[model samples]
Target: MKAVLKRCLLGLATFSLVAAASGAGAADPFPQKPITLIVPWAAGGSTDILARVLSEHLTRSLGQPVIVDNKPGASGNIGSAMVARARPDGYTLLVGSMSTHAMNPALMPNMPFRGVEDFTPLGLLAYVTNTMVVNPSVPAHNVKELIAYARANPGKLAYASAGPGSTNHLSAVLFEKMAGVQMLHVPYKGGAPAVVDTVAGQTQLLFSAGTQTLPHVRANKLRLLAVTEAKRSPLLPNVPTVAETVPGYELSVWYGAFGPVGMPPALVTRLNLEINRIMSLPDVKEKMNAIGVETATSTPQQFAAILHRDADRYGKLIRDLGIKGE
Candidate 1:
């Protein structure tokens, strides 16, 4: 009887130890599997390229493969909505842009998710250098000349945008309002298509990212007038800025990472730290510079502030311009 009683106690003790050990082992690290970074744009565009580059670096740093899933549509709404609705487990993330996060909520009346409220802001990744370029046949060499011609042509000249409410569209709209010109607006499904059309003369002008336009410019297919940043890009130092020609006109296109709202604060901190570290690397900077993007990094708080400020600023702009989503 004593031996039987002792065996029963030992079995209970063994069971408890095994349970505790199992629980401890189950408390694995944050990223136990691969991560998916959603790029809310078509593959082969500037956003896609940047996301791919960042994913490669992240895979190396995070010990798991970071895959880019392209979900391009509705000027980035489709993919963004997916991220907004994803589980806040940090595995499903977004590589978003200023257009998707800041401008779309204001432009689209029926957005599926609230831009600021539905996502956890990670950090700013980089700024895409936008440039004003025209088909060589348009015969404009600089921003001033282009504006003068646009003013003269009125509704005759046409400019292509990635889509309605894209930064490309807003940039041109701001240019028109500031310069007092009225060129026609053409919307395309994506930046690559828009730039291709511009190069093929389907559109007369394009305010596009340097990644899509630089190759054409180098090939003498599209003529670069001025960069859209407040200052000249080191990539094209000799080229002036649109702000240089039109004072107080600045539109910056930025990219950042995001996860669904309610993501663990610890996870967000980990991602921000890792991403900032990646951005600070020399090779990352060089690669970004080569693609006409300047790498940038910020704390999660700072990135949240940027989203709020830009949403307010661009919301007013969209309302005043009467822009709508398609």
Candidate 2:
């Protein structure tokens, strides 16, 4: 009887130890499975391409596949809302943009998600170069010339944008307000479509990302007027900045990564470090530069500050301009 009791006691102890070990293992490190990177824009656009490139590098770095899932609509609100509502686990992430994080909230009346509060900013990915381009048929060689012509023609000239609340839209609005000109505003469903229509001469002007417009410029389908950055782009040294002609006209779009709110701080730190490292790579910089994208990396705190600042800046601008979402 004493030997049987001893064996039972030992078995019970062994079971407890095994259970505790299992529990510890269950709380394993992040990215135990594939990660979903939500790109809140249509495929083949700048955001989608950037997300895909980063996802490829992230997969190699983290030892798990990082898939880019496009859920584009409502000027990036549909997909952004999905990310905002996703579980706080590191498995779900966002390839967010200024349009979704800053511009949309200010322009859209019924935003589905609270842009800043619903997500944890992991890091800033890049600052995309925006250029003002016109169809080859337009009689404008530079920014000053374009403004002169627009002023001469008034509402006869029309400009294309990604949508109502997009950076493209706001950039054009700012241009109008500063230049003291009024041209027709044509908003499309996405940047790709807007670029397509502008290339087809359905619209006369476009202020769009370099990745989307550079190829058209090179192909001679569109003519580059002025870049919207404060300074001339290294990729286009001869092309002057809009600020050169219109003193304070500067608008640049940026991209960043985000995780759902309540993500583990350690996980956020890990992602920010890895992404910054990836963005700093020589090969990565070369690739991004080729498409007219400047690699920009920032800490989580810095990124959050940028969001807050832009939100205030753009929100007031949107209200002041009476801009409404589509």
Candidate 3:
């Protein structure tokens, strides 16, 4: 009887140790491991650039490595779907843009995930200064001149876009529709390559964010005609808006942080606060602004609201314009 009791006590002690370890792990703070920040685009582009910058700050602030993972394909649906399917443990996050979240669902057929339902919007990161630019060799000074030139050239003027349903493509299409001109559409795999072709004069015009086009503009390789925002950007108040020349044409692109749906509310708030703080840093804002990116900060709710509104707006636009994926 005594021997049997001894064995029982020994087993009890072992079980207690295992239970204690399990409890400790469960009680540990959030982000006990490195976090993944998926960019959903190729490196060296605006979204990738912004993700890397935010990841550096996040790594320092979160006490864990916020690694950036780029999964570029199908107009950003690949990386975004990966994040949507990820566990909502705060370790996996996404730096999603308006194109991926607001526009792609409407633009792409066989979409992998619903942008609004599959994820939790964490915070607004920045607003890209969407611009319409022409290769320096193009005979156009401003929006009016560019419109006139495009009208005169018609199908002779080729405009490079990131892809068939990319924001750049949509912007250029809207420009053609509103201005009553027909420019040949040259779709590239991504914005960087499209901008490259435009700068090389292979394509005479490009509708892309300022981050990619403005540097070339400054170098005289490209000429900035106007922004795509509803109003002028504070960063470049002198630059006219496309609406001024082509009435009712506006496309505002923004980026936001997101995690898989069903993330803990506490974790969502914590991350939202961190992102807001990071974007509000003086140097971060200044650096982004230099390239025509305006850093924006907001609550998770506000981000979600913006996401819903843009999704609806762009969805209608795509349908009305009969945009299709490649």
Candidate 4:
């Protein structure tokens, strides 16, 4: 009987040790594993560029590898949906944009997820200098000339877009309505291709972020017409704005970080602080600025507010514009 009692006590001690170890493991700090930073665009675009740079800094800040994976297609919905469906443990995150989180739902029929509901806003990342450029061969020197040419040639001025309902698409469509002109919209699968085709003169006009359009503009393959911001960009103050010719024509595009819904509030706060700090770093700012991206940051709540606001604003704009997803 004593031997039996001794064996039972020994088993109890072993069980206690295992239970304690299990509790310790559960209590281990977050990011016990590598995190995936999904960029819902092709590599070399502004989104991918920002994601890579951010992942590098985040890897150091979080003390774990932050991997950037490019998952481009369906106007950024494919990768965004993947992140939306990912486990909300903060292991997976998305480098999403105004279009993906704001405009896509209203634009795309049968959207897979709710932009605000399916994700937790982590932080606002940066704003790109969106520009209007045309093939050098197009006989337009500036926004006024482009509008005049489009009015004269209506539907003859072929414009390129990332896809239907993309920023570039909406930018051009709005330009047409406000300028009282007509242009052919040629939609491509992504921005890079649209820029390439526009440079090659397959399509003549393109309104895209400077990261994609500026290089070709410098190369003389395309002409810089005007910026799509309401105010002239500080980085390119000398450049005129589309609003200068087409009043109230604004297409300010911004990038942001997001995790799946149900992410811990603590985690969201921690990431927002770290990401804002990283964006404010001088070297990081300079790096992004070189690509015409202005690094901006915001609290998680502020970022969420922007998402909700843009979603509503763009929803109305898309509908009023008679935009339909293909």
Q: Rate the local accuracy (lDDT) of all candidates.
A: 0.90, 0.89, 0.90, 0.89
Looking at model 2, residue 33 earns an lDDT score of 91
What ranking emerges by lDDT with the best candidate at the front?
Answer: 1, 3, 4, 2
141-197: candidate 3 lDDT, tens digit per residue: 998998788778779999999888888998888788778998899998877899999
lDDT of 2 by residue, 37-138 (tens): 999878987678788889999999999999999998777889989989989988889999887888788777888999889999999999888989999999
- Per-residue lDDT tens digits of candidate 4, residues 1-326? 99999999999999999999999998888779999999988898767888888999999989999999999888789999999999998899999999888898898889988888999999999999999998889888988888888888978899999778888998888888888988888899877899889888899999998988787878888899899987888778899999988887888899999999999888888889989999999998898899899999999999999899888887888999778776
For model 2, how big is the CA root-mean-square deviation? 3.1
Q: Give per-model TM-scores.
A: 0.86, 0.86, 0.85, 0.85
Summing lDDT over every window of 10 consecutive residues in candidate 4, give the lowest-scoring window: 41-50
- When 1 and 2 are scored with lDDT, the better candidate is 1
Clash list (residue pairs), candidate 3: none
Clashes of each: 0, 0, 0, 0
In candidate 1, which residue ranges exceed 4 Å CA deviation? 1-27, 137-139, 200-202
Worst 10 residues of 2 by lDDT: 41-50
For model 2, which pairs clash? none
Cα error, residue 20 of model 2, in Å, equals 6.2
Off by over 4 Å in 3: 1-28, 151-156
